[model samples]
Target chain A: MATREIAGTTVEVNDEGYLTNPDQWNEEIAKVIAREEGIGELTEGHWKVVKFLRDDFKEKGVMPTIRRVKNAGGIPTKDLYELFPEGPLKKSSKVAGLQKPASCI
Target chain B: MMKRVLILGAGTAGTMMANHLARRLDRKDWSLTIVDQHKTHYYQPGFLFIPFGVYGEQDVIKSKREFIPDGVEYIEQKIELIEPDSNKVRLGDGTVLAYDILIVATGSKIFPEEIEGLKEDGWFKNVFDFYTIEGASALREALKDFKGGKLVVHLSEMPIKCPVAPLEFTFLADWFLHTQGIRNETELIYITPLSEAFTKHNCAVVLNYLLEEKRIHMETDFNVERVDETANRIIGYDGREIDYDLLVTIPTNMGDPVIARSGMGDDLNFIPTHKHNLQSKSHENVFVIGDATDLPSSKAGSVAHFQGDVLTENILNFISGNPLKDDFDGHANCFIESGFGKAFLIDFNYDIEPVEGTFPLPVIGPFSLLKETRVNHMGKLAFRWIYWNILLKGRPMPGIKTRMQTLGKRLPKIA
Candidate 1:
């Protein structure tokens, strides 16, 4: 519900710091958000998850679950955790500029 | 030549569908058959009460044969595979049941083996899941011997059946422990993979308040890595650990293995289903109901009951070469047990979150929504009678509607 500046780029974000508009996202914004999430850098594995979240959200109109990311995105859950430490699914989706994954509630 | 409708899994949904189609489809033109491996039809909601000593196994169990409508052939054998390409289902003994239409009602189940060390040394001793009859029975014994340290109730993953059961268990634990004079001694905790106690924003706020009021500790965004039996603690993906005297866990829930064997399911083995019509995404003749479908609705028995109304009509439509009606709105209402003979009733759908209001009546409900009351708990207890007598038989409940009512609901300005 608020706008924030990340790495000299402006984008709207929710209270949880998830980017409200995915179209406003760029590599610079991803890097800055990744840094905020305690992930120092974005590797090839990170972009693979990021790319899947972006494209899948575009097609499905909602954030895919962790199982979907692993099954369809071809990223093993272990590597996903290693790629984005702490919380892989939510963190990756945030860096990917997608909404938080809902629990069907 | 007579057309056949083969229903799978003979559970709550399938039995209802059989009863529905039996009354709807003329016996001269259509024949009905249902299949399952088990003869016992469990009142799944009653499982929550088992651990708290509210209900026994005999109370929840009944002959699956009791609810199945007459003239519908019931096959008490294993379902081997669903060959959607040929519109046939092969049974365990290699018998094939060919059908013009198929209804899948195979519900979700808790799989404890999905996590490392959960089903090992400490299973049923320290770690337990009340989703099954055996698990609940064993947990009853575990609860009996409780002096108490940290009683951690954890949710293993998302999209679980009876989404509110764990929360109910936690609240009931508080009440039970108080009765045993162990409330002060027990450090009750509720853990989840979701970012909050409950997923829906409006409901979460209310539930989180209840958790605080009951003094139950809240832990969020914790994806369990494994249960370390040696140390008697659960390790998270981030290496966070919480020790427990007793661990009541809702393990990974998945669709039946037959869905995977047929190569017709998603990652979780849930068949891809049309949310509105309850039709299979891949095959037109195959319809999915209950937890078998990958619908964004709670996988509770009440949802299966709601789906029963719409799916029956859609099947009748599909039978007569008519277009499938998009009448289902994912309407679901649940009584959330908060213990102490009090509960909260929440009514919601795909687009709307639960709001405060009267349910099924405008300004004159015997039960209130989003507010804990004894009437809601009474309603929940009364549902078991309804489930057995009316719901499973597919008889219409006069007061309830298939779609959600907006009459008494106080809608919030959703952002």
Candidate 2:
């Protein structure tokens, strides 16, 4: 199993550096993961997306889609790009301490 | 002695021709045989969706035997040589099969080694391609960890299968990054040898607008000299450099090596074929289809489907001693995925460029032309099912004509 050092803790990651166990994630770990993803810091807006994704994943047992994120998380399409840069769902999902969304590819 | 028809490859063109000819030709008169190295048939168009994880492995692969109809002999062997003088093909296992007619459907392959440093160091690691199943699968992993950086999507040269695929990848990359929340941090660059975004003038104009809209930096006429891997940049013949953090390139595509060894091909090993009838210029008994033929049309599945229909009739006419008709008009139609659940459809032939139009109907099409719509995206998704069930089986599609029609086309006005 692949592993990554986050916040001085060794966490399991898949071959693509996505979190293997959602339980291993925390607020500090999200900050470290965001930095690694090139997002210098996670703001309140970022946290809103992260929290929404985590809560939705907890309820649905699956990562929310871009449409769901945009609708439920209240993040518009433009703001989503502004926040995540290249892959908002993928980046925010990682920072939000959730598994990679299956529908992304 | 019974007349024999031997097809070289069991791919799209080969499989369709085999199915089409079996029904048309007499059972006792003609014995059809198809030779290919593998038993698995890949829905190659689906390879474009693989890297994006839009399609899984099982979704694109099927047993070749499933599509190859009865009354045809399936020979699983690598071809050794084609002695056109004697009209015989030698298989790798020393079996020589003589044919009354031969169809060359062996398609093009990516020649990664042809480019310097392409196969070295970062291949499948950072620098990757999605042209093959393995390459696409590897790219899925590479794209996962890619945090905002310079992502360069390049085409080594022209005449590659599905020419619009690179642009589709670029557009999807923009969407994919946006979904990953790295669109701001990433710089998406599209490098090509063509002066414009696409092959056609008017189409390139619209595509260039789309590229500008997506903010994908276009570097045109970039004749790649070599990949300077240590410096993480591609050096063109003109000494220009484009650096990349992640490089997804479509390498130089060439016809099967067997075509070269047999002295039956051009500089790129593509068989010189009649653009109209698809018959080989060198031999009347030989017919070429798909990417193997040096046709002026786009080397796409739609062209192959159209050529298959025409070639089937021509082959029958040839057997009956009738004059071959100049039927094939290089008709091709493709759905260009433009990201965000919308896609654009372009339909054209040899003479006409892609114009604003409705397809198969006049101004009341269920699908629009040269314009992006969710319906076109649905059509694009529905095609995979159609390709397997309807197309490969040689069944005619309703309302989709084999010939190009100008009925609903909105032509450019002369100034």
Candidate 3:
């Protein structure tokens, strides 16, 4: 697959709009991938979630579940759903353009 | 016999239109005249940052005459009425200026008086709007003594300049109160008529999260019925009362008074303009731009800049008796300030809503769309300089285009 450029990040999506390279994600593509996954508009506070998700994936080398993303992002469980609205972790991962981690069924 | 074009206001919209049309129209063939009541031009968007001590009054104001080109004649006077049938405009001094073409670019005004009880006792006492030079300066004073309480930032209605400013105010207020050690003392509340914090669904989702994260109280769909200034309470249409110590209300906005006197506007006094062509629905020889028109978009300076380009083409076509191209797709953009030294940029036109994407370039926008970044905050600040030098001078920005592009934007799910 050919690499497409988005804010210095090399992104390649299949017909289903999945990121071929999850590690290649930057802030710009993170928003694009999130919106594509139905996260809608990513606001200022949502950055906390994005940063947390990216950090969790980097350290754990695996995608974080809702519980992990909540703990990592430091946002309350109620606030997480308000921020993601589409069910956190699952929804945010799809929008962040991150590949599904081995932990998630 | 030279063709004379008279532009009614020398503010942001009028100044840009003059700069554009003066260059397009041959000086020998067409005489351009711009009339404004005040000699000073104000950077309106700067008003948003003023209350927070981010921008000073000196940074936002400039002489209106300085921006008008040498070839363009600027007359500082009040317009009494537009005699469109006779192709003449009457001035306050009883001087009748005739024109071959008239451009109505007089921007909007804040009518705080329209809101009962708001202007009577608590005009600038407890309630203030950061939309005008005086209001902004006064709010700065009010903020100085603002120790703590329920600090409510609100929008009276939609169609306000820089729609995100109130949201920006809420964010900045959160940052401001926290820095002052008053965050715990103050209860930050955002009272808007919008179902969410913003108009568009996409942006609203992000804003709702911001309100939640910042611990700012959000009361959506609360249409303010009146303000009980003595009691420091806002009464909503649904009989909901929100108490506040300091009320920063973005008052009702309407088009210039000239539109009402001339009978060229709708109920709200906004000109009825052809959405695409920029031609006034009232007359063929007249055109409307900026906040003067009842366009279903954010009444921001960027939209006027884009309209200036489109109107330039249409005006020439009108002069030549050629078919006018309806090309302006309501391209409006605004940098949403999110405080804590971060901002978000959103660009869209009539058909398209602001979506997540890179702007200017498909994959490499230094500024993020719909997401707050420190760089976007810098861009918003940098625009103040650009407005004075480039945008108002009628020069084309090399990187930025007049048209809104969907190249980088991810298309919404096709329903």
Task: Report each candidate's C-alpha RMSD, comma-separated, in the order given.
Answer: 2.5, 21.9, 15.5
Instruction: Compose the digit string of candidate 3's lDDT tens values, residues A1-105.
Output: 766666676678655555767766667887776666677678876787767777777775556645355444667555666676633555666566676533200
Alpha-carbon runs more than 4 Å astray in model 3: A1-105, B413-415
Q: Candidate 2's C-alpha lDDT?
A: 0.88
For residue B225, model 2's alpha carbon misses the true position, in angstroms, by 0.1
TM-score of each: 0.94, 0.79, 0.79
Q: After superposition, how far is residue B220 of candidate 2 from its true place, in Å?
A: 0.5
Please give the range of 10 consecutive residues that has the lowest summed lDDT in model 1 chain A: A96-105
In terms of lDDT, which candidate is stronger, 1 or 3? 1
Model 2 misplaced stretches (Cα beyond 4 Å): A1-105, B413-415
For candidate 3, the lDDT comes to 0.82
Which numbered prediction scores highest in DockQ against the true structure?
A: 1
| lDDT (tens digit, per residue) of candidate 2 on A3-47 | 878898889998878888888888999999899999878898888
What does candidate 2's lDDT look like per residue over B61-119, in tens digits?
A: 99999999987999999999999889999999999999999999999989999788899
DockQ score of the complex predicted as candidate 2: 0.01
The superposed Cα distance between candidate 1 and the true structure at residue B255, in angstroms, equals 0.4
List ranges where model 1 is wrong by over 4 Å: A1-29, A32-38, A52-62, A71-74, B413-415
Q: Pick the candidate with the highest TM-score.
A: 1
